[model samples]
Target: MTDPDTAATDAHLLETLANLRWNRFHTIVVLLFGLGWALDAFEVTLIGNVLGALRQHFHLGSNAMSFILAAWFAGLMLGASGFGILSDRYGRRRVFLASLVLYGVATLATAFAPDLAALMVLRLIAGIGVGAEYAAINAAIAELVPSRSRGRASAIVLNFWPVGSFVAALLAWLVLSALPADLGWRVVFALGGAIALSAAWFRRHLPESPRWLIEAGRREDARVIIGRIAAGLTDATTLAPAPVVQRVRREVNGLRVLLRHYPGRLALGAVLDFAEASGYYGLFAFLPIVVLPALHLPPARLPLFYLAGSVGALIGGFAAASLLDRIGRGVTVAGFYLATALALIGFAAITGMGAGAIMLGFALVNLLATGSWIAAYPMFAELFPTSLRATGIGASVAVGRIGAALSPFLVGYVGARSMPAALVMLAGFWALGAVAVLVWRRRGGIEARGLALEQLAVEPARYV
Candidate 1:
């Protein structure tokens, strides 16, 4: 147990860190971290764009392709769960760098895979790297940014995802238009890996989270980092001197702690994550197998559709960033969840329309889906205390990946029979998320908007 005096000191440090104004340092942190996240998006979009080429080269059917997608999601589940624990117990910066390097190297190697089995294994490894980033990056950003702007900051970082998607779409179009399918796909993966590796080098400059440091009983180290953050601020306020305390290390299982103490938050996060993941992944899966054939568009033109939808994603992400701090987390998140569900239904309804109508529907659905996740990521990070934040985020993502993993297969199975049915199934997932958020709010769950992490860290019962 923590000593009362030491706890007080820790509280003061946290308050000081949380109250700092946004600065160049914070901007740099967001950009670097956001770039890593964008790489995940780039990878996903790249694979989606190249699915036709992959299928032709490997002699695979729609079900086999879905299995490959499932393999990647399975790796994500394992990586998020395992790395979340490691980040909490060890440090965020190291894990952040390590995950990036692993992703970069694995993805680069994927370009050279000789057969179906090799490609599946490489994709799985790359998925593990990207999955680790999901936990570590979200937790680090939540702790590093000021509480007042945490929502917007996280949304802005998420905004980079669509940007990456846009770039991937554009690149896929350019490369595939100029080169052979087999060669173009390899080049895209290689470029993505090279970009990821370059970003990792720059991320070496990011500092460790002071909150995590203090939680680990490294008070002096936290103080030094905090001092550096405040050094160049024009309006910097002085914080209390660090209290001399021995390092008190506790050997506790983060997962067990979360299950025992914060079951509701865990369930809520998982539900929201599941809703967004299924909708998002299902859309990509449906596009290649269902939408392309329905529109009578060639495989090469699929990237153009993604390119168009990415514009909607950017707009939706920015809109979410603006509303999150103004409307509050509960309202913003639940509203987006409900809106996305409605949009998905509309998308399915418009499937019989011309290619122009389908394109418009695709953009609108991407917009709403982007909004849902932009608001949800920060909420997941804020739901738990510093000690278990990454673990909580990772566990939620792991559970969500179950939905993500199955979504493609669901689309392939149901979509083969009925496209509308598959889409409605995805819409149901979003509706479930909306209901879960409403239930949490009615039960007196924490609002979390503009509240310091320390303030939000109280027992769920206390909020009630």
Candidate 2:
């Protein structure tokens, strides 16, 4: 070959290698993060699915079980807030690893709970771990991915929640109901503990986010980790090093810093998150009761209802993942919430009208609303810069978790009075969430994917 032709070919080969490396890096991050997310989903959603068993085991009623679930979410709210601040201050690496251990130990402890009080305490601790882990992992993913692909990547990783929840539902059906009471729930708790080990394994694969590293003024360390990550992919060998990142160190304050500066973002994050939590958790946490009566199934058959909803959630997650990249984040989230609100209202009407409608509407609402919003985590994380990414997201999640924690209590309270009233209340919450998300998009930018990671790395004081 001519010398000029040889040079062109070599350049093309290097370019192809670079593209491959980038894709591999993206895929590995998503899969590792997704695995952790799945475990989180399993623990969080398991409460709803297993409520029947717990109620029967404790010789309690639905209202009491709702209280138990609420306690878990309350703990989640506190955990997310506290751990989010700690993660940002100490580093995602330490916070992430610690949360895994905390939740795992808590879950194991749950298996040995002798009474409702013991169960509630263990679940609260487990909830804290689950809540904190979500903030840490989501922040980690937000920092790791490039801006252009952030929405899609976030959607994909977030989809694992349904995957884990569905798997847990299936296992609860196969294992919990069939086994003796003590053994059954204990096994499920053991599973939750076992699954948490994935966090440790997952952290091994993840290096500190380059964005976080840059913000911390560890450019050399960031560069070395990036090189190792690059080498992990079978694309480029002896690749050009990533550019050195220089970031300013800023005085770190807690929520006060958020209140003083970027109040707009904080308000936006909190309102939007609160709405989502209310809508998502309100319906999801009550899935068993919603479906059990309508399906006309025996107590033994109730799990099938959960299993179906879980499938819907899983499918919805995958569908959300598929469209997140193509559709704008604002449009996707608003559209889902809007549709969900309408569908839920319709569901209440239909179910109130008759039995057949109840069965159908219950399935549709669960599938669409819960599944669609799984993609929102990335968009939420993107709303703030790196310095407060965890804090912002964590605080929002904490607020939302409060809503979630309350949802079951709200449902049980209303259900005792009237089922139709409960459904109407849920529809209202969904509408509220839909409105909050729409307003957020109108005020903020339309395309959250365009947000640069470096911008997130900007100190809180200088954020623009």
Candidate 3:
């Protein structure tokens, strides 16, 4: 149990942090954390770009390729589920740096893999690192940023994902054009490793989250970090002493607590995550097998399609960043999901048109789909308290990865029978997410707009 004095002090420190104006310190935190998302995107895009080369070099068949893909997602699920608990138990800074090193070293090793088995193992390890980043980065950013700008700040971090994807596509094109397929893919993996290591080095300078420190019963550490943050702000005027309500409670197992106390939130997060992952992954799966062939597009030109999709992702991310604070999280996320469903329907209807028309439809669907997740990520981080934030986020991400892993198979099975049915099935996933968010909102879910983390933790849910 928390001491009364410590609880009051924790409240005061949080209030101070929440009221501070944006400054250089917060900017650095966002940029550093954002790189994690970018690196994950780069790794994912690089793998997709190099699959044909890998298949050729290894002389592998369909089953082998499927297993390789499954290994990466499996690693992601395990990492997110395991490392999230570590982050909550140890500290965000330690797990953050360690996960980066693991991913960097594993990816670099992958570049030198002599056999198909070695390559698969390395990919799985690298994926674990990226999965760990999802939990750590989201929790850290939410705790560090002020309440008023948290939504936009988190959205901005998510925006870096598309930037990374675009860079990977561009890099793959240039490298493959200059080198042999075998050497080019190796170089791409090497570059990804170098970038991750570099980011990890810079991240050493980042301070531990004050909120986490306090929750861990380290008041002095929290105070020192809070002081350092305030010292960096130019408008660091003295904050008025705010009245503190005594709300401290005994610590318990986070997962158990989540099940007992926040079942509604856990369900909401899982449903939203599963919907987005399956729908987005399902669309990509359908495209390579069903849509591209119908459009008479060759596999060699897949990079161009990815580049177009990246542009749409960037546009959608920016739109989410702009709308999240103004329109509120629930409304913004639900709206984007609904828009994506409609866009998918339109895309399905236009599949028989010219290549340009089909690509345009594809980009439109990507735009709305990307926006949905960008808005939803902040919600995942905001729904839980500091003590369990990473765990909660990790659990949701793991659940989502399960959906991601199965989406391709579902799409393949359904698409093999009927193209329109596959597209409609993806649309149904998005619609389910939209309905879930709307129901949560109607049933008094927390909005989390311009509210401090402490306030959100203690306040009763109400219509926003």
All candidates: TM-score: 0.95, 0.86, 0.92
Error of 3 at 288 (Å): 3.6
Q: Rank the candidates by lDDT, best first.
A: 1, 3, 2
Best by TM-score: 1
Position 58, candidate 1: lDDT: 80
- Estimate, for each residue in 66-136, the C-alpha lDDT of model 3 and write its tens digit: 56766787788888878887788777887898999999899888889988889989988987998898889
Candidate with more favorable, higher TM-score: 2 or 3: 3
Report the C-alpha lDDT of model 2 over 1-464, residue by residue, as the tens digit: 24776545433432322233346777887887788888888887677667767767887766777778888888889889988987776667667778888888898788888999999998899889888887798888776665667777788888888788778778888876688755777788888788787566655656666556555645456555556655664222232332223211242465676777766567656765776677777776555555554444444455566667677777777777777677766677777767777787777666556545655666678777765567567666776766678888888888888778788788767766767677778778767766766665566543554556544434443222
Error of 1 at 457 (Å): 0.9
Collision pairs in model 2: 385-456, 386-456
Candidate 1 residue-wise lDDT, 42-153, digit = tens: 9878888888778767877888889889989988898898898778877787789999999899889988988889989999999899889889999999998888999999
Backbone clash pairs in model 1 (N, Cα, C under 3 Å; residues 3+ apart or in different chains), count: 0
Sort by TM-score, best first: 1, 3, 2
lDDT of each: 0.85, 0.70, 0.81
Off by over 4 Å in 1: 232-252, 462-464
Clashing pairs in 3: none
- Regions of model 3 farther than 4 Å from truth: 59-63, 233-252, 289-299, 459-464
Candidate 2 weakest lDDT stretch, 10 residues: 239-248
